[model samples]
Target: MTPEPRSGRPRSSSREVLSEAACELFLEQGYDATSVSDITRRAGVSRSSFFNYFAAKSDVLWSGFDEQVNAAARRLRGGEAVDAALTGIGDGLAPDALALAITNADAMGIAGELDRDRAVRQFRLQRELAARFVRDGMPQLAAEVRAGALAAAVLAAVWAWADRTAAERVLRDLLATTIALA
Candidate 1:
């Protein structure tokens, strides 16, 4: 017999299972209509297990990217050059997950919300990238400008690729082109 959600410790894979279940439900019934209860039921986990993995429903889409960003930030702090740090960021981009989220954005009833979140995330990332560049010896003003343009390009590339099949290649090519242009 399976243990109840709160009755026993969750498996190590609980977070992935919960995220997958939430994405499935979000694609089916729409994000606005799917509750945490519905997700837990689908995953056969307790409601508390949902909270253990994510702070909120929207986090299902962003958590992987957040982890990547955090990791890139740590690398930057280790004194990596701006170009190298951005390459690390590109390496961590989960194109498949991002494409899935974008495809379901309208169905999930989070088109606007996702856009807002993306903008905010990009703004913060750009600022941090610029700071890191300055720390690596670029002038502050040049660093800021370069980071802004690079961030915009990266976001545009990702958004454009989200609708395309074989998005991983597109993302890679776009990032390579952007870095070359920079």
Candidate 2:
């Protein structure tokens, strides 16, 4: 039988390992030069394992937040209040690969990549939020307006929280402050 890895590490941690490896490689060699194979090699996992967690290379920096955004979308659609649903976006978030990339985009040479990927996520949240508001009896245009502002707030709070030094980070508090904008 193949021996299991030790130290209580779970199969799911492969995602985290791949993200860390990708971030380190991006810093070491820049994003365009660091391929998926490079990340898999550095992370000590197979290419298939890398795909198990991320769809593409740029996904290494966006998956965690994307997961949270999806969770928040589910919560909102399930009749959760807007503030509660939006704030929950930060519930389990920690300083992660995306934060590292944001803070060191210049060194990692991923500024353009960050902007392009982030816009996709921001609008996704906006679309989800707008639908939720419409279900809650908001007029169409007002729902869109409110959702747009709240979506921007959610992204801003996430970005600000990520920008903080890890030692001082508190995501829920930041979420609360930003959610107040809506």
Q: Top TM-score: which candidate number? A: 2
How far does residue 105 in candidate 1 sit from its true spot (Å)?
1.9
Candidate 1: 10-residue stretch with minimal lDDT: 163-172
Candidate 1 lDDT by residue in tens digits, 11-121 = 777767777888888888887889999988888889988888788777777776677777767877887765666656557566544567787788877788689878977
Model 2 pairs in collision? none
In model 1, pairs of residues that clash are none
Estimated TM-score for each candidate: 0.80, 0.91
Of candidate 2, the 10-residue stretch with the lowest lDDT total is 4-13
